[model samples]
Target: MNDNIKSFLSVLALVAVGASATLWWHDMMELRWESRRTMSEAARKDRMLAATRLLQQNGRVVNSVGSLGELIVPKVGGGTMILSGASGTALPGQAEEMLDWVRRGNTLIAEPRSLTSAEKAALAALDPSSEENDDEIEDEEEEVEEPKPAAAPASAQGKDEDKPKDDEDEEEDEEEDHTPPEPPARSYFTAVASDNKDPLTDRFGARVRRDAKACECRTEPAEEDKDKPEAIAAARRERDKTVSRLILPGKSYPLELDGGKMELVGLPNAVAPLWSDDDGGAVRVYREGKGQVVLVTNDYFSNYMLDERDHAQLLLALTELTPGRHVTIVRNLNVLPWYKALWRNYSLFLISLAGGVALMFWAAVRRFGPIIPAPKAERRSLLEHIDASGAWLWKADGGRQVLLEAAREDTLALIRRRAPALFRLPETQLWATLARDCSLPKADVSEALQQDAASHVTRFTRQIRTLQELRNHYER
Candidate 1:
């Protein structure tokens, strides 16, 4: 190849290397972003999806990655609806609309992070104190039991024999009047709490905290609940089973579906204590109007959980209990599916990026104008270089090192050019001779060069200037 061709090839090689480096760096960053997208997508699909098949069984399923209000409107026909991951943070008038849906006999199951202000306000109409007042009234009625008037004086016992039937009737009426009245029905929301003193919670009921225990498929009802209605008893049984299945499977077995652990949302006491571990109440239900609201503290119905012990049976029973055939699963309206993995839908971005890279590559291979000779490094005077170095060292807070080095260099140079015989002398003797020639005290010269330079800007400047003066005097 000709000399001109050789030169062009060298330039071309350099350009290729630079472009390759740029491409490599970009690829590395893209790989990291791609990895993160994969992880999050896997989490959403595997952890959050509750079924092997998507809402495909048993009912007219309306599945949406949107809020309850957006997916189902007001007076939407009654059905079994589940809103999982519900933070209770609604958009606009959604909360009111939901409450209306419940009033119309639709069961709304909500999993909230805690007692939301919106829920508290809506359910506040049901007072918990009314029950206590009713109990007090019942106690007073028991105290007023009519006692048969002290038996009439013994002497008159035989005189009233004919009127005995009338007295018996009167006693019967008094006994009936003493009977305690039936207690009034009360409804309120409660949760599991160690200290149930918050007025709001107290106004409702102290939250129950159940302890953790090994998973059990079935637990006998509390003694008090054994006499409850059959339907209520069955509901409680299923609820407990479901709560046990939701408990995080510990080290012995991992739920294959790794939906992240469910956070502790407030346990709403809409239902009775149907399910409880030693730690606290796990599930509850509350009746509002003709419908009921079920609250679960964690994500017990996740796909992995659904496969755990007794979970499938509990879910089936729950579905059968619903009044309608339509089952709605509501995910948070705020979590946008597309936003979670932007890189997965990057066709347009990649196209634009590729075009930009191609354009730059083409430009690199083609010269824009006549190639000017490459500039050579301009040589500078030694003193100019030294001055530049000193300025840099000063800016970097290395003034002490620069000043000491400069003083030593001056002493050596002076010894070489003006006092050749002193070049063979020891360091101390050399410094002493330089000090004598410069009329600086030997101690001062030694201190400036051997000791540390001052850190203060003014002091450092003065010391360096003094040293420089001594060097100049010797150079002259």
Candidate 2:
């Protein structure tokens, strides 16, 4: 082949390879774009963020407070307050205050707090069986006490019959008056959908209900079923089926509620059922004074569940009932951070504390008068040097003997200067001469001159003192 033909073939091959690479890159990009589109965005931290936004979108002023304590009630035209994670039993005093606020023409939407152990025990004590037994006994006694009447004259018989009838009516009235009042109904959340028709549910064109089963389903298996795998599997299957989806008119949504059941007893004012479950009423309403209180059995307005079924619709309908356009949602109760609470409730105290600390730091760093000159550095005194040297020598091993020998040598040298003849004498004679010259005892002079180890501080101190005196005497 010619050179031009070969070059043209090479150029054509390069073009083909470039097109293939470009197509491959475009395919990978498309796959990545599809995957990214399928992935969900990051979840919000606040559980009620969606609900809050929903209220705002409906032209209502929504405010989210941390706790019930921080909730600010309007002075006029009371508005609606939604207690998301709060309950009446959690804070009795605060709950009562909120109720009083409600009585002044406001609406409070809250769930009831879970019953305590003592409360549960008290409820258990009021058993229906016991009440039924008492009623049966009373009925038997009344039957046994029936009395037969004797025949009387026509004129007196009529009056007698009318009098007995009057007496019987009065007795019946007394018995009715003496009867004990019925206990309040205990309501719980259930997986079964609510079939009741109410204003809240009617707004969404469907009934609202929690899909999860009652909390009691989470308990351990019974003793009889402990060893049976089949029994356990059946129980698990039962629990798994508790979750249900809400079938609306056109669409269905999963119910994702997270709350326990609550007892509706001992609540102030008369409670009217709004929604019912298999066990009891799941939602109730009552009036305090001019306003009303709506007690929900579960948290259906949480962030995760707000968009499910008719939860958001239900919330909107509730807020619309209030006189004003403002809505407050209390997310928690008594959950403020310590520092934030201190700053909010005790700002004066915190300000005073900060001022005091700042003053102390200023006093420490700032000069009270004109800047003072730095103290002049000076050499240590001769006595200080001597004391330091002596301390070091005393701490050394066999230091006491060395100290005595040095002192003795100095004394002997001084004596030699005073009397050179003393050096020729023997050690004992020199000690006696030194003792006489220094006016010290002969034994002390001899002990001080000897190279004996000092057993303790007292002996060492005495020997040092004697030698010092002899050296001074010889110098004199």
In order, candidate lDDTs are 0.54, 0.62
Q: What is the lDDT of candidate 2?
A: 0.62
Error of 2 at 190 (Å): 18
Runs in model 1 deviating more than 4 A are: 1-43, 46-48, 52-55, 59-62, 75-77, 115-280, 333-476
Best by TM-score: 2
Model 2, range 355-440, lDDT digits (tens) per residue? 99999989887766688899999999999998898888889987767777787788767777888888899988988887887789
lDDT for each residue of candidate 1 in 86-128, tens digit (9 for 90 to 100): 5344444555566667667767666543333344343333644
CA RMSD per model (angstroms): 36.6, 27.4
* Reference-based TM-score, model 1: 0.31
| Model 2 residue 332 lDDT score | 68
Model 1 accuracy (lDDT, Cα): 0.54
- List of clashing residue pairs for candidate 2: none
